[model samples]
Target: MTASVANDDGPQGLRRGAVGFGGVLFQSITFMAPAIATALSIPLGISYAGGATPLAVILALVACLIAANSIGQLSTHLPSAGSFYTFVSHGIHPKVGFLVAWGFLLGVIVGGPFLALQMGFVVAGTLNAEWGWSNDTWWIWTVLVCVLVFALGYRGITASTRAGLVLGAFEILVFVGISVTLIFQAGSDNTLQVFGTHYANNPDYQGFSGVIAASVFTILAFIGFEQAAPIAEEAHEPRRTVPRAILVSCLAIGAFYILNTYASAVAFGPAKMIGFTADDSNPWQNILARDAWGGIGFLLVFLALVNSIIANQNAANNSSTRTMFAMGRIRLLPPEFGRLNPFGSPMLALCAQLAVSLAVALFLGFHYDPVTGFGLTATILVDIFAPMYILLNVACLMYFWRFRRDEFNVVRHGVLPILGALAFVPAFFAGAGIPAFSFITALPKPLWYAGPIAGIWMVIGVIYLIVLNGRDPDRILETKRVFDEA
Candidate 1:
């Protein structure tokens, strides 16, 4: 493997692990797919425009597919440990690359705690319901889960992937079972109306903007597809596996979401679905329990929610540590961060991630109710990450334009990116606007808004880069060269 080192030897290349296509696919599905985000996206879709949620997802999927293809083009050319940051830097300019790295790193780091907190909520909810346990100390358990993730992640990519696979498979099976059962109950009429345009004919949601706002939240359902690119270095065949995993994951996730959301809508009916609001705690789970499975179904949904949180934590850990390792290797941080465990894991980087997560959990746990604390923290993390997610879409367009010149037809590279940008940019604004809107209305504010928080984070990154450049011009130059040659 070609090594790019700036100081001491970088973290050991991914250890030869037993993970294959199945493992990778499983990891992608589990880590990215099994979250409450997926389940709740149904109601979120309804929240946007009653029935247009699936259409929004379909549009988002098409947009993301184009972006993924652009990313795929880059993955084939240069599969690296750095993923999007590396690809964007090489494909575009180095400065933008640095921004990508910083944004992604912040997202993963903040997101780890958010995931842990969410898991804590699910566990607490389950235990309180089942065993009559107090959920007062949920943060303690959340921290323990985060610690477990930190330990497993420190072991190596293979261990993380393996764990992700098992969890992912279990979650998927549960989701399928629930979805299938719901569909059978709803029958064909409900299903057809759920997917059809009749739901969007509401007088309340007059224009495309309302539908777009609703769809934006629904798009969150598919956020994890990008996880494939970040872990490309661990794949046996980066060119083939990375792209295939992304495409397959997108298709599979989209199909599942459409079916699931349609079923949820059909089962609940349009009038009832409209009545379901965000204020209802565990609204989607409640809907599922009430309508579909009764008491037993509620228990199953609760269990799935707990598992989903755990799976998301594991995924966030894997992504955050690798991103830190990548930055460290490039001399953007201390050389120690680039060092590997005997098992070839980025131990220091993993520790860094855990440390940040612990601090966030402590702060949230102490300051607010468990649900509010976790929700705020998770929103902040998502807010920090969302712009980069948008940027990655833009990066995809630029990447294809530069490297895949032959395939850079306007339809594939230009038009699709525009559509993605259209889908994402408005959501980005809404993500930012919602916080302020909440503050004005005295609605509880989301922990973080994606636009401003991400902007500030990038500004800090730029300042850090300038200071580093002043301290070590030569190293900065070398870092610039890493992308220049390509």
Candidate 2:
């Protein structure tokens, strides 16, 4: 798994043993941005699944855990910065690996503006509601935080993961406490029925269909659980650490989502939960927080959201830049992207990521608004992520079957991967609004552009791959090489 050096000044490789299991685990946790998801995603789920949002969350959690198993299994064998890129290249075909690299990078790139816009939107909305401040200041916060993310990331992997650990712990504690309190405060309203299909009351997609529909959105909350895999090279005992971190983060965050959803359903009234997102003026969570803990509770929730975004961006930047560095090291991208600064960071990739994020956030934000722009980017991310996840599962099966046959187990390598891939099928169709199912609702008109945007990005990647292959057919094969493998 040694990286081949072409010359004297080739990539120095990421700082090995820079972080331990705790840092790796928190990197995944923070990247998922639990506080942000709890504050925003629950209401969105409730609107579609009513009181059965908890059930949908549980289903999504199961699917994610299944998918995580495949990712974890792959990480044990190939703990590289390229992550899915490495997994697919060796497990599947090198050409497919290049495509995965392309699509995966698209998810990471757009993920920048997606979280940045949300950070600004959350801050501006909180300030406007609490202190009568202008919401227009969102752009300023967006730009400032983009710079902060770059600065922290450039400092090194240790610094980035350490910051994420502290910030992730605080946000998780805050939300968990609030969720438990909300559940207890519900008193007689609390019931196990929220997890049953009967509570799914969405008028457009009733009962089981409502739960299925909401699962599409609920799955988004699990997007970053595999983030630890990308930084496996920098982590201590990565073969052990990366897999455990992925599984543990998924279970922890899954529990957190269930607790929050249950609390929200019971406290809001199960049948009336569909109205949860109707009144943007009076968010139920904020009102409940204020009622439960006075003014300070409201402020704490807002602070958690802000802290969540910062930590989320920090972890995400780590993953994206390292992956870029890996790709560049192998000549899939320009060599400049592989260069590390004096501080041991992928300097060029970091700069490019933040710059593109800032530019896209400003452009789309000014064209429409922060909220709409955030949604568009998120939609595109989900589109890219769903297919990539399926591909990863297939890669897992092929990797074990082709190369590790002696170690292969049918349950782990075959059935589980197939099940994981199958799990995303319903959600993908519903999210894409393909009209394949009568129960699924179409995406909003404004967000309809997400599909074509993702398609164009993938097509461009194919064209670039074809051109690169024509120049040197074996270049794509370098993606399988791992540097500093444990």
Candidate 3:
């Protein structure tokens, strides 16, 4: 009944109100993992968008904003850890909700290792860049990070958030400062040329399709916005804090992306747009090392990359565990997953998720380089995530516009959802088929990378949902009830 921090008297055994709006906001922002995205993700986006990287970023921002608004409205009603799964269930059907939960859980469980896999190389690269010593074994770093994430998450939400906030804030400050300095140094040459239409023909692109393709990858940078929703129940005044945190993080990160992309493009100037990003993974470090505070900037950028991955993993751990914890409570998953530790953390679920993450990171580490593994995992996740977003977008319209007409409005619930759906449609289709990142050289199915994986996972979800509905209708009802709770 309290709107503050969870204590020993808490009802569900999980700590409640462990943090406020700032805690949720920082978690969401860090979840986007902007520091590394600006450093690493910019190259992929720039290579695709040609000279129009900024425009691609803008397109991605608008799309994400539209989607964020849709989920924003949904969060105002059912503030649950299942997040989109909860929203879709109440808004649509229980069966579909089960599928979303299945797919999303699958994504995040692997997402930990996916992000961690990349961080491994980031750590190795940083060591080499800073101290002039090379470590060929990146998997060692992956193991170390996995331990830290699982251990920190095991402690409690408050400890995890405080650590993430401190590291996340420093990472953002250094990256943002570097980007702003880059912009100011451009002076007259710093035109809105980054947003120009000329990129489609800039001698490097395959027409406007390149920009369209680039928008798909850059859109991933805004992903952490939704992470706030999964932790809504842990927030102080969730209804107010969750939606505000989500929208604000979404837009704020979007602005940073636009400026960051523009500045990076400016660093390469107008002529080298294609050449600058092609095959370059360390663009941010490269530019920073060339600046006045070269040595300090290099070290900070490297640390930022390292921080980005850890913070992102911690954020993902918080989200994935809570979703599983909520699932376990409702019998959607194993009862063990729902069990809380004496310290109020979802210990069993943390171990379960961490095991899967470490296993995948080690498996991929042995087979491929970090970039390829990261790209492959990210491509698969995109396929999994798109449907969740699409369903949530449509579900919001169905819930507000049709079922709860009293709460429906022309703009907030109706137009925004439709716009969000419209925006994601093309991007979803364009990306779901191929490996958008060049670094990802191969897939199990060469012709259709994500299509097969996405299809099979979805089929499995449908089968499971059907079985659960047939065998345990009461549990289905219970799951629905969880979302309906105020």
Candidate 4:
């Protein structure tokens, strides 16, 4: 277990101890949440281009790998609590850093609740099937899960990471079982159709636009892999382990998604898979259970869903608190936001995160359908994080340009980051468009464009910083020096 930074008074910086590679790997896997990918991803891919859905995931992974390499490089040099925000601040400009931090914070704060709602939906659905109990409001379940998350999160990162490991392992086991079963069933018929151009050549398909849109959704499965870098301060070898964990996690997630999507396509037959409608709740689970597991399918899927929700909850709790802590340390937020509990956890930050999550869950529970709520939350996530990812990709290029000249090659540092930037740029636009499109259809829109929302938040942070500077310029100067040193 790593000890948190000691604070005589004011905000305590993050602790520096030594979390082993297993802990780092466990935390990374928890952030990835394999079951969440297994449950929601296939339908999202199929809805875009049917059998070609697997290809979209593969493409997305390729793009992410490019970005991950850059991130991996950056982590080795300047491992810190703010993750991308820290990288941007150190490698680029502070204003860009502010935007990245605000953008990522907005994404995680809003996205965390959305993930909680997902957990609630899965839990409620599982319980409904098992006990014949109908919980009409997902808020009820969301609230319960939030309470558990809050308790565990307040206890500290170690507990949360351990819980994540258990849930993540179960998710992997379930996913592997389904994949093996599907592969065996497909036998010789499992061909390359799922990855071929033929699957993408449908007249009814939304074409490039659909693939772009669906890729945004598919990319969500890879979202949290980089989150482990924020807690690098707690890792045994911050430079070495952080980069290794990030690259390993991204590769593992990409491989899992591609394999699972291909397996689903094989089991259903590529042609038939394309026709599967989104109307079926938990379409991925349905496909696997109906085709692969047969007799004990429902039970197997039910258990998987439970683990998925728990894994997501653990991720949400860890990410939100660490992000808040980072923001506080940078003076973008109040010093109180940086305070840790007696147990070495960011208690206030955890509470703040939980409060926001509860508010979203409650509002959505009262006002809209679970699916609609989920859509709105997903949109917010895409809107906020897409730009941050784009920025991070750019930051990676800058980091390589400035610091790693000897190590820099066009393919690894330059070409790859450029490709990653290209890959995520359209996703940013598509995500921005989703809310507007929803409004045109007379549907309730996501809260607002997260880029603009984050912009406003940054302005507020700037205003807060100005006020802090007026009262005590030294604090601001000291913080700036810390960032410079970092």
Candidate 5:
């Protein structure tokens, strides 16, 4: 038997073995942006799930873990910088892989401006609230953070992941500490009832229906757990490291999410938790922080938001740029995007991504305000991401069943992947306002455009794939040839 050639030592020149287990772990952790998710995304569950928000988080965790299992299994054999694109191309067909790559890039591309708008909004708002700084200067902060992320990413994967390690660790500690303190301070208010259907008091969506509805938002919070797969080509012993990073990050952050949601419910008094999103600003977390440690806790939480955005964007850029580089290398995109800087980083792809993200963010920020623009980008992200995830799960099942049949287990490849794909179905329909899911209720205006935009993008990708095949069929053929042989 022959050993497979490691992806890290490939011809891509992306600094092989530059990132270790810890670095790989934090890449996914920071990308998930646990602090931001806890402060913002988690509370969306409360509005629907009411006091049973923790139950929603647990359901989401299970769904994400199932999907992560499929992703981890694929990464073990096809650890390419293309990540999902690589997996799908080799596992399924190259044409479908091209579409997945295109759609996945659309999701990741918008993620940049999404987090940039968030950073600017959070920093500028915090300063205004605390020190009377002008919140109007958000665009300035947004640009600065984009530049910082670009610099870190350009320096190389090692530098960016190391930065993520520090930023990710601090944000996690601050949120975990505040959550524990809130739980303790709740005293008699803290109860396991928050995890039960009895406390699901939302009039519009209560009991199991509420939990299912809220899991949509909770699942979005777990979006970046598979980010480690993109950096696999740079990871030390990627076959082992990448799989561990994806699974562990999902489990760790899932637990972190559960704790934070429980504490938020208890601290705010479960009966009134349904009103957590009453204020568009969602000030409950900040109020809890201030009550716990006075001014210092408030300051730390604010800083954590800032840190989370920076770290999150940094990790996101690593994934997007590398995937772009991978596509470019295969001639699915222009060759320039495949080029690297002297530092062995995909500088061209990085520059192109930041330029586009910054422009989009600034236009949306000035046009509709930062918060609104942020929501728009986030909605678009979820629309693009949900389908891509379902596709990946399908690819995993196909890969093992058709190619590696002898090693395939019915439970791992068949049942888990089917369940993983099914889990996203309700969330996707609800998010897109399919009307079939009556429990979805009213959605924000941004979602109205998001679904259409994602559809247009997919149509465009299909057109492009057709043209690419006509012009140069070898490029698409080469995708499977490169790794399938390895």
Candidate 6:
């Protein structure tokens, strides 16, 4: 199980056996960043779905579970750092895999800024908690965090995953405790009222139509859970660990979201909901967090949110660095990225990712406010990820349908994959076009050109492939080496 056995002059091997099931689960779960998800996304979704936020989240979770099952099914068959990149190349078409890889890259790239901004927000709030080092310019904080995040990535997978495990546990504990306290405070109001049509007090909401509309945001929050698959090659017992991590993490995130959102809705009862969600500030801080378990509750929320952002950026970098290394090693792109450091980390690729994130964060910081920048960039991520998941589902279906027919189960291989793809239909429609299902209405006028942007991104990848093929006529066959040789 030599993960990479290139000659000394070429790519140095990645350190395998660094992440086990717990490592994958904690890293992926933190990437989901339940505290941040519940803090920001849930309230925004609640704005659309009204009091039925729990139901919208539940529907999104069901769709995510279906998609995750398909990914898990394929991880056992095509375990690699390339994740969907390797899967699609082998099962669909190698050219199509190129599109998925860069699309994924761009998506993960923006996440760094998003996570940095989140860290900045939490740090800003924590000033009153006897914390110092409050920067007037939040991008300063973004820069500082990026340095720390890159240092963590530079340390390689085991250090990053272990850090994620500790940070994730603390954040999850705070969020879960807050949820329970919020629900307990709800007392008589905590009945299954959130499941009912009791949102007349909610602003601009239209019953069931609104809840259905909000599922897009709910689904967006589930995007990070699948990052587990890309680490399959590095994880110990990846064939077993990757699939388990994907499934369990998805379920855990869903349950937490439902409980957390329910508690929020109950905590901010119908009368206060309208005024509370109307403001542009952090709703968690404005509404429930400050008063949480007393005044110091804000500190707990702040700590969890900050920890979540750091852990999430580390996890995102882990996935991106590995994917870049995978693409480079397969000869689909330049091999320099595949060349690792003495410590076995894809150091050059990690550096590239950090530089891009900083540049983009700087540009957006100057051009737009953090909220709009975050919203628009996050929409791109959601849009890009939809296709990655869709392709992986197709790859899983085809992998079983053609190559290993004996191992194929109708539901696991065929029906589940098909269902998973279908579940994302609304996401495609929401992202691509149609005025009805706009996922995030909050972003400023420079809207996310989800389909056009994705199409252009693919076109660029295809052009690169054409050039690579011209340089080495055997590029396609060489790229398929892992699929055939493995």
Highest TM-score: give the candidate number. 2
- Tens digits of lDDT, candidate 5, 1-486: 122222333335566788999999999999999999988988877788888999999999999999999999999998888888788887789888888888987876688899999988888988887789998999999999999999999898889999999999999999899889988898988799878898888887878888888888789899999999998878888999999999999999999999988988888788888887676464644687887787898888888888999999999999999988888777777777777776678867999888988998999899989999998888888787788789889999999999999989999999999999999887777656666676765556764777788889899988888888999888776666433223
Assess every candidate by TM-score. 0.88, 0.96, 0.92, 0.89, 0.95, 0.91
lDDT of 5: 0.85
Better of 2 and 4 by lDDT: 2
Off by over 4 Å in 1: 1-11, 16-18, 129-131, 201-203, 206-209, 277-280, 287-294, 434-452, 473-486
**Best lDDT goes to which candidate?**
2
Model 5: runs farther than 4 Å from truth?
1-11, 441-446, 481-486
4 versus 6: better TM-score goes to = 6
lDDT of 3 by residue, 152-258 (tens): 89888888888888878888888788888887887777877668666544454555666766787688777778788988877788888988988999999899888
Minimum summed lDDT over a 10-residue window in model 1 is located at 435-444
| Candidate 2: pairs in clash | none
Task: For residues 1-486, write the lDDT of model 6, one tens digit per residue.
Answer: 555544557655666777878899986798898888888776766767777778889888988998888888878777788887777877788767767776777776777887776665567545633457544457777788889989988887888898999989998888888888888887888767567556633455667666777777688778888889877767888888998999999999899999888887788775455455676456675458765676667767777778878888888889988888887776565788888765578877889889988887777766876555666677677678887888888988887888889998998888888888877877766655545454434333555554556678778877877886688756665434453124
Worst 10 residues of 6 by lDDT: 477-486
Q: After TM-score superposition, what is the CA distance of residue 220 in candidate 5 from its true location, in Å?
A: 0.8
lDDT of 4: 0.71
Clashing pairs in 5: none
- Greater lDDT among 4 and 6 belongs to 6
lDDT tens digits, residue span 1-486, model 4:
434355647657555644567667767777767777767754665666667778788777887778788788888877777777778876676656766766677776677678777876777776776587676756677888788888888777777777777778877877788888888888997888667656664455544544554566677678777767877776677788878888888888788888888887787777666566545667556657767677477667777776777777777677678777867865667767788887677777888888888887778756876656777777677777777777777887887788778877888778888888778776666555644432112223544443465567768768765676578665443322232123
TM value for model 3: 0.92
Write the number of the candidate with greater lDDT, choosing between 1 and 6.
6
lDDT ranking, high to low: 2, 5, 3, 6, 4, 1
Backbone clash numbers for all candidates listed: 2, 0, 1, 2, 0, 0
- Where does candidate 3 stray beyond 4 Å? 1-13, 128-135, 199-210, 434-449, 483-486
Selected candidate, larger lDDT, 2 vs 6: 2
lDDT of each: 0.66, 0.86, 0.77, 0.71, 0.85, 0.76
